[model samples]
Target: MSTRKDSLKFTMTSRALKLLGQNLYARPWSAVSELVANGIDAGATTIYVSMTEDPATNTGTLEVLDNGSGMTEEDLEHYVSIGFDKRAVTGTLKSSRAPMGRKGIGKLAALYLSNEYYIHTKTAPKAGKQFDSSWHMQLDFMTDADKEPTLREINATTIPTIHLNEQFNKQDSGTLITIPEIELKGLGTQAFKSLASRLAIHFLKDVLPDLKIYFSHQKINEDPRFKEVEWHPAYGNFLLLSTTKSHTYVQDKIKRKVLIQSASRKDSTTVETSITPTPSFPLNDFENADIANHISTSHNSNTISGAYFPDPLSTQTYPYDLKGWLALHATIKTTLAQDNDSTFTKNQFFSPTQIRLYVRGKLALEDLRPYLNLTEQYANYLEGELQFDLLDEDDLPDIATTSRESFDTEDPRFTTLCILVRDWAQILINERSRIAQREKERLVKITANANNAYAKRLSQSIQKLSESKKRPEEVIQEVHLGLTDNDPLEPDAHTAAKEEYRIFISHSSSNKPIADIIYDMLIELGALPEEIFYSSKDTVSTDKTKQFKMLEKQIRETITDAATKICYITSKGFCSSVYCCFEGGAGWATRAVSDYELITTTYAHKPDWLDAGLQTTSIIDQTGTFTLNRETYMLFTQTINRLVEHLNVGRRIKQEPLINSILEDKIPSDYKLRTRKEKISDYYNPILADMITHAGKSDHSAEV
Candidate 1:
């Protein structure tokens, strides 16, 4: 074999070389990258960040100061230049590094984060130079005449302002990158904790494997207070083997490898993750004769089967080094070990961890957003990441991106890559599922224990409220609710949850204050805000419809599925006007079944005459029988709380599954088809019977 080194000359002048400027990387994390790259380049033992923010613009002001070897005047010139390719990034690292940015283009990504980026340094044996550049319009104006590099000498005056945490002056040498105009999009205090957490996790696994890492003022990686950090592979350190055996078996064997322990809670540990080669598995290889012409490898049915993968999953084996082994990885979120706030950063939400498929030790595919909706999905749970590696670039050319941050699916080797990735994905997803189940069970047990403790605390509060002669001022400030809708306990076997119901709200203009309070009270009591309708001037929008969407909004916002009765708080306001009568009538007519209630201490001397010419309202006295609004709030809160208690959190719940439910088995007899001609007079009894039956079973029969 003969070997020779080849070289190419750059005929283009320094000025002609394209200055990528800011439009280099895609996202905000680029700033994170530039500094980290410098740290890796400097071979620093520690990297500290002082990331500040301005609420007005929701932007960041971050400074990454490290204690790595500094640059000299000669080195500084080339260091600041746009041509790093002319120089070498390879250095004596504290340890080896795969180099996060393979394209040597991440420096341009920094321009995406800040309008102004300043690099100040004080290296060994020479005074430091200060260079500040404006990335704004750089991408769009890279060719503009006015565009010029901004450089200056480091002097005493600029030192104090730019040198944050001035420990660098007396020290040996290091680099400082100041993102003066950090234009963070959708970042805030909420994202700060999140960004730090992500950096900690990524650095822990890929970048800073040999040393301890820190974030903020906290020792995220190695504080004595915190246990040692490690990501233990499930199969310990297993040998990666490959053979001429079926690729499906290769996938199956890969699937059978091991998983990593959960960093979070016990239930959240990864255990069942592995690639499967079995044909019976959903994410395995297959063969399709119709598209046979497309395959170039001239595979028999068995070989095509290796290339064939399921749609969406592409369950097929990914080609690897015809001789080397495949490497796959799974992820787990430390539910128990992690801080509760780990899943978010500056309002940016992420899953606890992700299911990443890899081959030959490179990331191939991952779904960060199962549905691309962390906010829309199980809100309380979101935060995760994935790292994978596939076959050697030679065997899986189409399987890897040039930079390898992404995968190239439609490539020539894509079919095999799809099968491998799909199998790996299933394994990773399975691990995540197991962890999720364990987490849920653990949460349930913890909640049950907490509830027992809560019950005792609630007992004390109940006692105090009962014994107190004068109610606390808090009671007066709180919103009030109306009557309860306790379905009569039937002597016969009862069904599960009841039928569709509404919580009617009746009010007069004079009592808007109380009525508003009542509406809030009902919501706190677990009533669907949609089930309660309120009359508000502001509720209407400019695009007014004849149906008066305002009324719909008012009702929908206040009502919920569990509501089934109306609480009528009447007063002198009621007997005096049409406003009061209309309010009551609206509540009555708006529901599938309307139950009215009145709150007061005094009964009308002549009740019917006092409410003459108006719709009928069931009135109750506040003197007894749960007359107090607060009492109703408590009652309803308790009832709804029970329903909530029964319905498990983070798990889907259906009305039909509720034990001993209402509408489930006993639909009200009245729901039977009533003929338009059957007559209003003949309908009352049968309709009522059906109503009673349905009231005892099933879902609300409608959305609130």
Candidate 2:
């Protein structure tokens, strides 16, 4: 639409257009993720992102180009058109069960990253003769807001064939997406490298040996970089089920079996089973009082200890000695169509991740396996990708999000998939345990039993476990849960973690006041003190060298031998003392040995001495555990009643209307740690903020 004045004319608002251009990409990360996805979708082995800044102007540019199947002119027009609404009204759309386009909206995500971008591309030999050798398209919406975007054929003859400043390269027939608009701050090479590394750890994996991913200018060969996750000798060889190439992942309920899609589609003798065993280890361990605590109380109110693996060791490959499950490493899906929308970021996983349950080279759970998405239960660790055959000929909507990093959870297949996975979760924990046990026995025989007697015993104990219907083994998946700082601002989060958690606390004597307070608070909430792992001054002897070893020995004996959840407390003493840091060091060292979670929190505004409880509370919250507080605890315990119900009833934690009632009010945040008045702070202060901002519950509670 255009309007013209007889004597007056309006210049095209280039500035408005520029703003639109700059804001085109919703998030910078999304833009980069999109480029990476394109490569994966095109079968690129190595994806490199080169980030550099020109110090003189301080204006920076990030270049992310890939060696995937380059698009032709036709693909550019049909798939990259602006404001395309091919799938907005039509719920998730999947056809042939293998396509990955959100009709076409995923491309505009690039516009949101920066105002200006240059797209360079090349085509494969199959359809090459029609297009230019290498064409460039530059668009900057932020600088010129009102003008229609201009696209023209560009000559790349004079440009650098090789990007020297970026020191990057491209494959013979690939695409290059250069983002020339870094408005806020120019990222350093290190930041880009780190992101690239994290992505590789996630999307690019060891499980699918055929699939390959590269970061930086360097290639990622199998080495220290992509090591398997080690659960230590204590956890036994957590082997990666290299179920051979014959294993086919099937999700009959998710889509439908398309006999025509497979050259071999015969039904097998694969048996379906249930996962009914409660994991060998209890969450809070209320069942047994004889166990010792490895970590200590937080010494603060509001939050409990978190799960953290010690450093160095925490990051090491799976300690099983036997090759860990690569399939579990960064959840991999061999079928590209089965992946989330390729139009969005290429290598991102969607939430409510589900795992595929396979048995005897066949999928036991037709669709879902590992993740339990009762959405009712508020399961967040439920993230993963199921790799199976395309025997099911079903139409699936694009599995990618707007940015294309993950799947479109709203799709109907998602729920159907969940039902399928739930069945597998039921089966694996029950019948499969027998099979896993058999495999373990065979593996044990292969080891010749010299020094791993303890591992053998642990596996034996696991095999002998009594069956509980929850089927804990089904919870296993290859998803990495990363939580940044809690938005001290988010409304009360779901504390459903209550049913499925094993916590470990670590602290020092200087903060005992706060630690004890935090410990009591957690205990009231159902956490056993022994699981708290209390440590004091005498625990660390004057012998400095022995400090690390001593701490390791005690903790290893407790956490490794006992816990599933781990948390670390940071007080002034812990932060100031080299011994304490070394104790922290020991925690990091043993992550390869024991899967202990390490989370640190300290008081934000309180004084160093008086705020001991505050500091302890801060660290617990930092670990990112969903929290509950004193008032809620009493009400919760009262509602459920009988410690026996909470401890052994085996029923899932039933959330009530009162649970939502906790939303408006802080559970009395004014009290100090450990005191009867203070125990109300087990929350990450979320409910507190909620009361203040929305209902003033904290202040009104004092009046009541």
Candidate 3:
């Protein structure tokens, strides 16, 4: 032990072999796609994937047959050799098709999918050779606790011949891989269709347009049916943003015609069921053109090229170029019943809504969201496919992880791509925010108009009721009429005791019903009509300039007067109105010069600005029903008492009677009131309220 040997030998146990076989892939589709990539690397033009399910055993058989340049005897040995790099043998793929597979361990995907599988293969016929031989082999990863098993121990047997399909026999060579006991639970038609769609995405359509994939499914005792899963990219009402403005997708007011293909198999005869040209909207006609325009302007020129220092200490730099289209989806939901396409449909298990990155036509990263670590507002609505083949170029160092799911994020090449994607995502988010703001403003304007109409009706109803000496019995059926506004003693007949303090009613025109209730309650409690500045009656001029002048003069005089009491009626409508905001700002200024007693309609309708520091009496809730409880009634009484003490005025009517009348009779009889049990402790924070009330009093005294 004192002197180590010149070189130490490394060995892998049987348990390590099993671990590599079983835990190589994270998803079922990913493992399956690896097999597909192998076929593509072999220069396959047509591939067929067939799956059979047995519901009883929760297992099935899966077979992948491809008319590709099949493997030779030497190639078979290389496949079983774990961790063998095929790149060392062949620099590039046949026909210059970019090889999607490098690490020869793609065979682990088949091992992970099934306990045992069979592979039958034959190479392309020689120039003069008439009879060609096919090979058949069975393999499994057997783990033993005591002994380690090596891949070299596996054996293969020679067969007379193997036929791929009706078109390809001994003369034409291909490969057929069959997994007899694949442990796949609930494998059916839908699962196969989903796999086909995902494979199309894994191997993009643009890169492999010549490749056609067909899927067939079978149950325990049923005939197998096949469907040609066409490669279709799903996008509806989308705008294409690229590194170049001259791209076809970026053209304005152009309709794109895409071929919609479907295939059905009837007894080995494949029929093209439908082939239609479905037109899609262009940039100018896009529903979300404003957002698309911003994305376009953000990219003045369309090229994304950067140089990165691969070695931090070295002066040499390597240049990389990125090509892809980033598309923003206006709506993920299907707009029409006819628009329901399987590739476009999203389910709990699968969703096409992801930003996929491809390296040499093989999916390197499933989604860029995880790589970028984005939590943007509309991050989910963005989907794209980017290609950065330089990362996989032969001259560059192999940077892809073992699983091939992602690259080394610390790499300068990947980091440069991340920065560009993040910038594009930010542009989409910024535009979405702008569109949201415009929609909010439009909704606010519509609400203001509706509220103004309602306020006018409420004003008319009050005027008509005041014109007649209607008794309580006469107006018992009317839910709007209450004792405060329609008591035996009329408001004009019984004079309110003169008081120095004035009440300012701040509310939106739509909230007049609640505001009128507060106004009548104040009048019944001895606040004179002159001492209250309610814009409804105070600003009665029809001319716009006169009405503005009347509102301005009344608000300035009442709010500046030291001893003015304020009643604010806050609601959604109130917050939307510019006039109400101005009034609220003026009322808030009065707290420094006057000991203002503030009362709000309800806690739910309380504006966010007033939530932190302001102290007010919040009585009713949003539904026009009273928050009837001991805590609320006590808070209301205390606020009114403070106002009465400060103003030195006599109560024309008791506070309890007016509050009870408003709670019991002002709202509709069906609007039942309940005691809110939860958060009742928060309803009455009298210590905090008293502090704020006294703070304003000290400010008033100092001002005087």
> Best TM-score goes to which candidate?
3
Query: In candidate 3, which residue pairs clash?
Result: 243-302, 244-302
Each candidate's clash count: 76, 92, 2
Question: How close to the true structure is residue 390 of candidate 3, measured as C-alpha lDDT?
Answer: 63
lDDT by residue for model 3 (224-333), tens: 56677765455433433333332335333212422111111000111111111112223342223232221111223565554555554666656665666665544355
TM-score of each: 0.42, 0.36, 0.54
Cα-based lDDT for every prediction: 0.40, 0.37, 0.56
On a 0 to 100 scale, what is the lDDT of residue 170 in model 1?
57
Ranking by lDDT: 3, 1, 2
User: How close is each model in CA RMSD to the real structure?
Assistant: 19.4, 27.3, 24.0
Per residue, candidate 1 scores C-alpha lDDT tens digits across 189-231 of: 5565555554454443433544443444222222222222233
Q: In candidate 2, what are the lDDT values of residues 279-377, reduced to their tens digit?
A: 222324311222113112222221222121213233422110111111111112223222321211223322213343322112223224323533322
Q: Quick one: ranking by TM-score, best first? A: 3, 1, 2
Give the per-residue Cα lDDT of candidate 1 at 62. 62
